[model samples]
Target: MVSNQNSKNLYQALWSSADILRSKMDANEYKNYLLGIVFYKYLSDRMLVFAVDLLEESASDLEEAQVIFTKAMDDGEVKDDLLYALKDEFSYLIEPSLTFTALVHDVYRGKFQLEDLAQGFRNIEQSNELFENLFEDVDLYSKKLGATPQKQNQTIANVMKELADLDLAHQGDILGDAYEYLISQFASESGKKAGEFYTPQPISELMTRIAIDGKEDQKGFSVYDPTMGSGSLLLNVRRFSNEKGFINYFGQELNTSTFNLARMNMILHGVDSANQHLRNGDTLDGDWPTEEPTNFDAVLMNPPYSAKWSGEKGFLDDPRFSMYGVLAPKSKADFAFLLHGYYHLKESGVMAIILPHGVLFRGNSEGKIREILLRNGAIDTVIGLPANIFFSTSIPTTVIILKKNRPNQDVLFIDASNGFTKGKNQNVLEPNHIEAIIDTYQKRVSIEKYAHLATFDEIKENDFNLNIPRYVDTFEEEEPIHLGELAQEIAATNDSLAQAEKELATLFGELVSTSPEIEKELAQFRQLLHGGGLE
Candidate 1:
């Protein structure tokens, strides 16, 4: 089981290594270097563990086992057999000279070279089709590292030594959690670009739970995220299942760097490379899942909001959009992504997508799309999330949950916009808030002032607009006041004021008898106080 202590260790280890690279470049640029080294160390450590296990049959301890394995690797036949077996299982192999431990040892001995690290990346990528171009983003010789080769080598050596001290092998989910921590840290620093590849953890958890609500015990359960984004959201689905290894993961990322991040995340989490099918391309422009009428059991995504698309006339014939008759407008592809995911949802599947509020009320092509989805009962529930929960934008977003083959047309609306714990940088959905959403969704019951179950006629009465406020009344009523009581209080205040004024006038008369000039000034003040002109 994953624990908070493991997460803390991973965060600290990655942050400590990040400190060495912080002064050299921004988070956006330094992340590639930092994540690349950590992934390399994970692969190298995995190889060491495999070799140590194999050597334990003949040797007494790990140190003595390494001596025997080194002698075995020097032999041609034995090396070929080991490489074939390791490559078949892991889909990649690390050489003794280029392994992470070897590089760390060189760093301590003051003899490490940047070229050896670069070659190690090349060798791993060349070993199998799965790892091709995986290290393209990690440019060891980039000027961001240093202006000179010698300086670049020194900088990389420091990172290697810092990462060498971390024990990534024992703790569950340490490497995966560390990679996620680094990605999140970089995303927070990357500003608007963060939305392209990362989704906040709380939102990911909520979506995953919603998607996997009733599919906890099924065998061979599959989950997909069309807009995978570092694969954190997709990986989150596995946690809800009783059998983790029974789940197969599928995802596509538009960004190459983030695509690699997803792949690294999958492998570090103990997912076999064969179980994950990740591709890099525009999710809207092409038809994926082309492997013979494939539909997933659960689909979860937080796609980019209102991104522009071609919306060409040719897409009218595409099965994903053809049924709508009018494509989603080119200015807003929110529904376009929805239709794409909906097209791949199984008859018994559930899909949850995070989108802007405009998707709920926008007219024309988007409205037509909403109408068809509502009539067909594809939209199961609409959840309004708090504003500023995302690092990229503060726009209040909604999670639209869809299900196919439904017998009823009722849609559940949850007003979670007011359900969050405020934070310094961004609002957060606490555990209670998340559970409230799930409980209400699963029970299909309405909570006072928080949720409402609307029938098809109620939605159509509002002209097919599925806005939450129209269905759920979150309007807070103020306490009522009694006009008669207020008037009596005002009258009592006036009487008290009049009595105080008379007492003040008596005190001024005493001062008038003492001095003539003072009495003249006091008379003017008394006249002004009694509503007479000061002049």
Candidate 2:
């Protein structure tokens, strides 16, 4: 376990490395290098610590462990055996010369080369399937780092020196959270592009809690996120689940860079490679995980809102969207993404998806799908979240909770759009607000204006719009104004105004100006005040 003070120190150290890259590139581009270096250091540090523990020696720290390992590797008799043991323990082996500690030593000696670091990354990528091309996004030779090779090497060296003191081996449990913190900070700097790879933590927590409800203690619980940006949303299941290590994580992402990010996130979080089933492909273009146990217990998503898709006619026959009798519009594939995840849900599972509110009121294909989902009781709840909570878009969004084989056709509508703390750059759902929303969702009872449980008949009466306002009334009526009291107050105000003007006129009459121009101006002001023209 990592202590609070240790975690804070690690976060500051990791974030400070960004400053070295700030002048070289923007946060969006520099995040890859920073995160890649941090992850590499983690692997190297862990390797040293694991090797030291395996040696059963009293190594004081990683530096001593590195020296011992280097001397052991120098001995031809023990080198091969040590390499075999390391491979067995870590599923990959880092050379004594290429470890982060060795590289830091090189940096101090002014003997570091960019190729050495690149080779280290390549060595890990080629070692095992789990780490294959994991650092593909970290382009060492990119011109963004510097125009010349020496400058790039120096920049990377500077960043490494800044982060050389991070005790990743001891803080293994909290490293993943610190990595997430850096990613979020980068997202804040990336602006709209943040949506491509990150979901706000609070939103992720809410969706995870709702999806994992009633199944926290289930062994081997499985969760899937079709757009598993950074794999943060999928990892949230472990936080709310009783079976942390036993949960299976399944996810897919379209962006290769983001796909790699998800892989690193999972590894840093200590998710077992065997339990991670992530793919890099379009979730809508073709269905993945077409193998056994495809359906998951809890499916959560925060895909691109209203993104364009192929939406071909062939999708009508595809099982994921076929049941709906129509495909989601190409201009807005929100439902298409929704149906894909919903299709992979277990019969007893729960799913929660965040999308723009347009899905609830849009007509045509989306409206038809909404109508069918409502009639079948698949749509269980509609939660209207606050606007500007996301870094991607400022428009308010909704979380539509769905369940399979549900008995009731009633949908619980929660208007949580107004329940959030105002932030400098975005609205925030504090812990209490999230609890309130989850409480309403679990109770399934109607609050006066916050929530409403509408029956199938009520939805039918509204033409199956599924819009939240149709079920929950969030309109706050203004206090009534009395004409008699208003008139009395206005009259009293006018009387006071007249009395003040009279006093001002008396004071003006008593003024004795030395300058003729001032006296003339004072006389004109007095005339205007007495004539009631000032009003």
Candidate 3:
């Protein structure tokens, strides 16, 4: 078992590997290489452990096991059995020649070749259909790594040596969380592109908790994120559900590189390949997860804000949008994504999506869609979050929760904009704030100034507008003034001013040797004290 101290040490060691290449490339470019190598180390360690266990199973003692393993390395039958077993178990295999331990030792001995590790990645990618093209983003030969082959080899060697010092095989979440931590650090540094691949952790937590509130104990519980970025949001569902219960994870990412990151994140966090189904494609244009049924137990998303899509008339027949009878405008695809995910959601499941405030009040096609969802009682709750809470954009956002066939057509509106604690760079929703919102949502009651339950009649009376302030009144009134206290305070201030003027006059008389200009200034000051100064 790995101790807490050992885990912390491992995280620090793994993270420092980036410092070696910090000057050579930006986080966007260097992340692929750094994380790819760390994943390689994990795969290598896993294979070695499996091999050692296989050797120990048949031998009498540990020393005898090592001797048997050494002898088995030269036997074709043993090699074939080990390869088949490892491939079946891990969906990939690493040979002794290209294992991370072997490569690190080779670098120390001045006999390392970058091609060996590159070939290892290729072989793994080819070993199983699940791992195909997984390492396509890791380009060791890119100029970003180094200019020349020898220089690239040295740079990689330096990173390898730094990573080799860390114990990544610890039986804990240390390595996986460290990888996530590094991804977040890069996201913070990547600016606009951060939103393309990352959703801030706090937001992910809040959305996941709300989506999985009443369905934690259900067997074979599954969750889906249509716009899954880095697979963080989809993976967050596991924390709220039974850990031993097999939960199927599904997601689709538009960007190829981000899609690869999502896959790598899934594997690094110990999610079996059989449980993860991620696809790289345009989620809005394509029907995703072609192999599985559409309905999911919970659907969560934080898609690109107001993204553009082809709202052509051809989509009028698309089952996802056909019922609405109008497509989301070409300029903003927010509703398009919602409707797509909504089509795939189980009737009993809940969907909580993060979108900009415009979706709540935008006119034209969006308004029509809002009216349809409102009339159908699909919109469950609208939560207003604080601004500057997201790293990519500072616009105030809202989480729109939807449930199919909710008996009570009332929509719960929560005004949590002022609930965040201010940070140096961004506002943050603490755990208490998150729980408060969830508690109020679960109880389905109105809290003064923070939440309100807007009945269907009231919403229709307001013309189906779900703006938060319209339902929850957060306006604070000013305090009343006291004229008597004000008069007494003014009189006291006048007396103090008179006393100050007299003292200043005496002091100026004692300093008669000063310049005439100083004397004139003091006379003016006295006049001002007596309320006789020129304006």
Candidate 4:
């Protein structure tokens, strides 16, 4: 564990590296360089520490560890043995010359070359399937870094120097948190593009809590996020689960760059390669994890809202959507994403998804699909979140909780739209607010104006529209108006106005103009104030 001040220092240190590249490119483009380098440094630092631990030797720091490793590598037998050990432990090898500490030393000596860093990245990617092409998005030769070779080298060197002093090796969770801090800062700067790769942390926490409410203690628990942007939402499960070490993470992303980000995020958080099941592909195009343990204990998603999809007729026969008898509209694949995740949910599992409110009330195919889910008692709860809670968009969104088998068709509606702290850039759900939601959800009881438990007949009464307002009556009747008191107040206001007008008329009467034309105008004004329109 890291102290709060140390965590703050680490976050600032990592974020400051971005300043070197901010002027040259937008956040979306520069984040690859910043994050890739940071991840490489983490791997290098860990490798040096692991080598020291394996040898049972005393090394004061990474610098000393690098020296020992370099001297050991001078002997052919020692070099081969060390390489095998590193490969077996980390599934990768970082040569003494290519380590982050060595690269920084070269930078200070004016001997650093872009190719060395590029080669280091290549070695890691080629080490194992888990790391294959992990650094593909970090393009060292891109003109975006600089126009000439020397300038690009200087640019990369500057960033490396900025990060060289940070203690990424021993700071366990702090290092991963700092990396997340950088990602969030970049997401804030990326604007609408942030939606493709990030979900607000509070929303992630809320969903994770709800999905893993009852089964927090279950061992070998699994969670899946089809649109696992940066894998932050998937990682939140570990935060709230008791079986953190045994939890399995399964996810897929359509964006290759974002997929790489998720992979790095997992490793930075110290997630084991064996426990991580991530794929870089379109989740909706085809089903993945098509093997044993296909379904998960929990499914959490915050997919792109209203994204266009093929919505081909062929999907109707697909097991995921076949039972619905209709496919989600092409213009809005919200339901398509929902059904896909729901299909992979275990019978006893709980799934939570964030989507636009339209899915609750929109008619036609979506309505029919929603009806089927509701009829089957799969739709468990609907939580309305405050607007402006996301960096990507200001529109308010809802979290719909689903379950597989239920005895009743009751749906809990929580109107938490107004329960967030207003922020300068976006609204935020404070801890208390999140707890209130989870408490209400677990209790399954209604609160006045805040929550409501509606029966199946009520939903059918409203034509099966699952809108929050229909279920939770947040409307507060205007405090009954006191007509008699209002009339008295109005009469008092009239009397005060009359008294002020009389005083004004008296003031005008005292104004006597010397010129005849001005006196005539004043007299007419006094006449109007006394009995004409003014009265």
Write the residue-wise lDDT of candidate 2 on 104-139 in tens digits.
999999999989989999999999998998988899
Model 3 worst lDDT run, 10 consecutive residues: 59-68
Number of the top TM-score candidate: 2
Which 10 consecutive residues of model 2 have the lowest summed lDDT?
526-535
Question: Model 4 segments beyond 4 Å from truth?
Answer: 1-3, 480-535
Model 1, span 459-520: residue lDDT tens: 99999998899989888889888999999999999989878777876775566547888778
Indicate the residue-level lDDT of 317 in model 2: 90
Error of 1 at 501 (Å): 18
Q: How close is candidate 1 to the true structure, as a TM-score?
A: 0.88
Q: Lowest-lDDT window of 10 residues in candidate 1?
A: 57-66
Superposition TM-score, candidate 4 onto the true structure: 0.91
- Candidate lDDT scores, in order, read 0.85, 0.90, 0.84, 0.91
- Residues 318-341 of candidate 3: C-alpha lDDT, one tens digit per residue: 888999999999999999999998
Score every model by TM-score: 0.88, 0.94, 0.89, 0.91
Give one digit per residue, the lDDT tens place, for model 4 in 433-455.
99999999999999999999999
Ranking by lDDT: 4, 2, 1, 3
| Candidate 4: pairs in clash | none
User: Model 3 off-target regions past 4 Å?
Assistant: 1-3, 57-71, 243-245, 483-535
